[model samples]
Target: MRIVIAGGHGQIALRLERLLAGRGDEVAGIIRKAEQGGDLREVGAEPVVLDLESASVEEVAERLRGADAAVFAAGAGPGSGVTRKDTVDKGAAVLFADAAVRAGVRRFVIVSSMGADPEHRGDEVFDVYLRAKGEADAYVRAQDALDWTILRPGALTDDPGTGLVRLEAHTGRGSVPRDDVAAVLAELVDTPATTGLTLELISGSTPVSVAVRSVAGN
Candidate 1:
């Protein structure tokens, strides 16, 4: 399989890239800086530098052309304020989906937040971030042309992955290792049966593959 991921330099994305390439899949990562290309290459993923915040739909679509799947893993990152949340989280996500539609990439995945809701009310920066993610998720869910699955993981930790997880529509609040999240994403990208599902992820007793298969079956 050929897979393209936005925010290729992100921690979870890097792990995912390594996993995909190790499995002999052709993987490409979209980054904002040329310097990040070497890191992607180190993990056996081709690097495509394209700023989704400013790139046109046609430009992104061109990059996505012939891709088997696309994953929206981009974000403004820590210390970013409200405006960037909207631009990177909401605007860029919508743009990537549009590009996917134009490129005819049916399978799409988004790394979202647990409480992401367009109706979520608050005033802090985290509040704005959730709203942005929620709005972006709403747009993707509305796209009839795409088979999209949104994975909303709980708090992220750097702990080693146990390869077990609780993936469901409402897994409640918990912490999950980035490794486990990436592992689940790897399975999700391959499970087209998971289409139209917005799943929550956290550490659990069930193995990653089993959890994914169970969700896909549902």
Candidate 2:
């Protein structure tokens, strides 16, 4: 399978790229900086330089051509303000879905946050972030042309992945390793039953493959 990942330089995206490439699948990562290309290449993923915030639908579609699936993993980093949250988190995700439709890619996986809801009441910045994620998820869910799954993981840790997780429509509040999140994403991309599902993930007793299969009814 050929997969395109937005936010190619992100920790989870890089982990997902390595996992897919290690399994002999072709992986391409979309990045904004040319310098990030070498890191992607080192992990066996082709790097395509395109800024999702400024790139047109046609431009993004051209990059997605012939790919089996697309993953929206982009985000405004920790230091970015609320405005960037709207542009990169919300706007970019919508753009990716549009381009996926234009390119005829039916499968899309979104890396969202736990607690992303329009009703979230928090500090100004956090509330804005949640709203952006909520809007992005809503947009993807509304797309009849795409078979999409949104994975919302809790606070991320750098711990090594245990390959175990609790995957459910709503798994409650918890934290999961970034590596484990990536592992779930790798499995989710090929799990058709996960389409239209918005799942929450966290570290748990169930192994990644089994958890995905169980939820997907495979």
What would the TM-scores of all predictions be? 0.99, 0.98
**Which 10 successive residues of model 2 have the least lDDT summed?**
117-126
Candidate-wise lDDT, in order = 0.96, 0.95
* Per-residue lDDT of candidate 1, residues 2-114 (tens digit): 99999999999999999999999999999999999999999999999999989999999999999999999999999999999999999999999999999999999999989
For candidate 2, give the lDDT of residue 45: 97
- Give the winner by TM-score: 1
lDDT of 2 by residue, 1-218 (tens): 99999999999999999999999999999999999999999988999999999999999999999999999999997989999999999999999999999999999999999999866777688889999999999999999999999999999999999998999998889999999999999999988789989999999999999999988988
How far in Å is the alpha carbon of 109 misplaced in model 1? 0.7
